[model samples]
Target: MIRLVLLLLLAAGPALADRPRDPGGSVALRVLEIAALEARGEEKRVAGDCLSACTMYLGLSTACFEPDAVLGFHGPRLAWGLPMTPATFEAVTRTMAAYYPPRIARRFLDDWRHTPRFARVEASRLIARGEARACD
Candidate 1:
């Protein structure tokens, strides 16, 4: 009986170990969580809308997008949900630039700076720009 119990426990170990944890909201926290997932050799597939901080996942080499995937990029603000100040926006832009490739980072910094809303990026454009590949 003890051996059977141990066998069951061992059988369940891989599934439990592969379970994904919630990626938190903050940029700092999500970055760490993404790093952990990357270390574990996990793939991040963006099928639907990936907005705001979620766009950070585009930085990961293992991340792929579905044909209909949409990514929304905007300047980051305070956790209190207040409007973004110049300093805060600059800081967020710098952080994002560090993560994203040069062309993608330039688009966010130059094109979307004064958009006043989330800048939507479709999978086709991302692929065309060499930012992401279509998911299998």
Candidate 2:
């Protein structure tokens, strides 16, 4: 019975793995996309630079990073792409808090408050801080 169950699980793995890749998009759009992917049991593997809105994928249930992966974070801005106003900053903080682990979300919000430039977080640091697992 155990072997039969194992075989069944193995056979089901491919179908889960066959989910389509997420086409990259804006921060808000990507959040929806990642949620869909999570619903399908898909995991995100960060192999390269994941900047700005791309860093939002870190919130996924199973997000892993290659050794060289880098993530960039900054405050959200207006539609015209100017710096965020206080309200926009609060909104962005709320969005991130909803998505990321509390510690990471707080750190990110603090960083956003401190700097207007993109803050780079390395994969090693993320792994060390338990924000992301190292990809196999």
Q: Pick the candidate with the highest TM-score.
A: 1
- Tens digits of per-residue lDDT, candidate 1, 6-71, equal 999999999766643222257777689679978998998876677767778878878888767777
Model 2 per-residue lDDT tens digits across residues 28-117: 787788889899988878866676667777788777888677776776655666676788678766775566667768877767635777
- In terms of lDDT, the poorest run of 10 residues in model 2 is 16-25
lDDT of all predictions: 0.75, 0.72
Steric clash pairs (candidate 2):
none
Clash totals for all candidate models: 0, 0
**RMSD over all Cα atoms, model 2:** 13.9
Best candidate, lDDT-wise? 1
Runs with alpha carbons beyond 4 Å of true place in candidate 1: 1-24, 83-85
lDDT of 1 at 97: 62
Q: How much does candidate 1 score in TM-score?
A: 0.72
For model 1, give the RMSD to the true fold. 11.7
Q: Candidates' TM-scores?
A: 0.72, 0.70
